[model samples]
Target: MIESRVLTQDVFEDLARHARRVEEAPWLEFVHGKLEVKARPDGNRGQIIAWLTRLCLQAYPDRWLHAYQGLRTETDGEGNARPDAVLAPIDTFVGQGEWASPDDVLMVVEVTSYDEDTDRRDRVEKPRAYAETGIPVYLLIDRDSCEVKVHSEPDGVRYEQVVTVPYGKTVTLPDPVGIELDTEPLKNWTR
Candidate 1:
């Protein structure tokens, strides 16, 4: 339980860099002033990301889905998050440091993992953090529930609209990201 009051952003960034250098250190995130350990993806999870990458590329060759891109999710720079994937125009991240600004991001994606804290971290915290940062969309692929949640229309405090659909159904990711996902393939990636 490392408290935010005790850890400056610079120190946390240094610690995060050190963890990256170590072999197999757990992925880390700083949200709501607390340090959190992100669960590593399993093989099935990896496949889902790969599939998404293919779909995204076929839809828009000018955009890219950057995996594990760390972001500064708060205006004050206190909250940092490493989204599973980020959708942006090609070259949007050029020369940006480890923590990139979310300004040009079209959408952020989080695929739920089989971990205890996932419900709170992915479902609750991430949506609020990304919305507060004024991100256009927050997409949640919930394997446990076999559903996909698309969060959009950020009004600063939270996303005003959230549409949820069961796996195998089609979901459109709204403008700024105008991609329609036929979620039938997602069923094959779940547990």
Candidate 2:
């Protein structure tokens, strides 16, 4: 039998520091004081991220769009999460380090990968976590379902407004990020 131990913030930071030095370290996140390892995204996932990043950058030229950036969703402990992409104001991210506070974030985009855990994290847990910190937008692209979900209007640990659209359609983001994302290319992606 194996026993599990919860890691403190300091311990988690130390592990993260070491992990960064390794050339081939898997993506690591500290979720509720527990270390969660994620595999490297495959080619299809990479293409989706790239497309979204490009679109976001083009849509909001004055903002910064970061891919796989670690976010600090909690102030008390290690509640670090790495979303597929983060959109923030240009001035807010200056001199920021590896982890950014969700308070400064304008929006978070997560593209679901090929796994059950990824589905739950992107569809459920991530929205709750991001909303808890009052992030204005949470955009989820669910490849498995061929759908895109937009979650906003945070109240408590959930978003008050939830909109879902199937692939080949367009989803309009709310004000501050008022752009319609076309999902035609995303619909062509296959497992």
Best by lDDT: 1
Residue 132 in model 1: shift from native, Å?
Answer: 0.5
Error of 1 at 26 (Å): 1.0
- List pairs with backbone clashes in candidate 1: none
Candidate 2 per-residue lDDT over residues 1-191, each given as its tens digit: 11116576666667777898999897777665456776677788788888887887898888877778888874352477888888887777556777777777888988888875776567777788788778888998888888989998989679999999999898898866788988889966746
Q: Which residue pairs of candidate 2 clash?
A: none
Off by over 4 Å in 2: 1-5, 75-77
Q: Relative to the unseen true structure, what is the C-alpha lDDT of residue 145 in candidate 2, on a scale of 0 to 100?
A: 87
lDDT of 1: 0.91
Q: What TM-score would every model get versus the actual structure?
A: 0.97, 0.89
lDDT of 1 by residue, 1-191 (tens): 69999987988899999999988898889988889899887888888888888888899999999988999987676888999999999898889978998989999999999999999999999899999999999999999999999999999989999999999999999999998999999989898
C-alpha lDDT (0 to 100) for residue 130 of candidate 1:
95
User: RMSD in Å for candidate 2, one decimal?
Assistant: 2.4
Report every candidate's CA lDDT: 0.91, 0.78
Mark the 10 consecutive residues where model 1 has the least summed lDDT. 71-80
